[model samples]
Target: MSRVKESIEVDVPVRTAYDQWTQFESFPQFMDGVERIEQRTDKLTHWVTKISGVKREFDAEITEQIPDAKVAWVTVAGEGEQSGLVTFQPIDPTHTQVTLMMDFDPEGMAENIGDKLGFVDRQVKGDLKRFKHFIEDRGTATGQWRGQV
Candidate 1:
């Protein structure tokens, strides 16, 4: 497995950032390669992605979630093996630090080569940067889910 971690500072409170994240379907607005996300339930999500001409579909189950703090998930059934975590830290009343970490296994030769070349790392960094812009520009979360698990 390969791991990638990236973080960004957004001009939004931790609560706002965390709330926006709970709306998983909005991920395609900022997450590159994420074609769509369907929130099947509070703890389950289905994902569709296409990167570098490879398309994949997967289901991920949220393993842990703490409002305004962190969320973690692991793939249950999918075209790939992966797990991830995202955290929100309050830098101040109007600033938040969002961090994302992911672990994935390279499935084939192309993926193995891309992994060696740091493709996933770069993608995650870019995704976080876009997320910063997405949330900061909105100035408020599209929606929120305060439930804990």
Candidate 2:
């Protein structure tokens, strides 16, 4: 198992950031490798991604979610499995500290090569940077799913 954690400060309200994150289908807009994210339910999601020329799909179950604070998830089932958490810490009313951690499988040669080359870490940081720009500039969410888990 490998874990990568990255954090960024977004110039947006905590709720605004958290709410935007909840808008799962819009993830592809800022999340670089995410080809699509389908919200199966409030606590479950299907994610398809392509990175370093490798494409994989996964299902994640949200284990815990606290509005404006944190969202944690574990892999339910998929081609590539992982567990991770995303926490939102309020630095101020207009700023939030966003952190993400993930543990996943490096399946074979391609996956291992990509991991050894620091491709994953760089990708995570790039995604966070894009997300920062996305939320700070646009206060409205792309879409939202408010059904209870």
* True-vs-predicted CA distance for residue 90, candidate 1, Å: 0.7
In candidate 2, which residue pairs clash?
none
Local error of candidate 1 at residue 2 (angstroms):
0.5
Candidate 1, 53-145: lDDT as tens digits = 999999999999999999999999979999999999999999999999999999999999999999998999999999999999999999999
List ranges where model 1 is wrong by over 4 Å: none
Please provide, for model 2 over 9-84, each residue's C-alpha lDDT reduced to its tens digit, 9 standing for 90 to 100: 9988888888888887888999988999998877889999987677889899999888877788898988887888
Clash count of each predicted structure: 0, 0
Candidate maximizing lDDT: 1
Per-model TM values vs. the true structure: 0.98, 0.92
lDDT of 2 at 24: 79
Backbone clashes in model 1, listed as residue pairs: none
Candidate 2 deviant stretches above 4 angstroms: 143-149
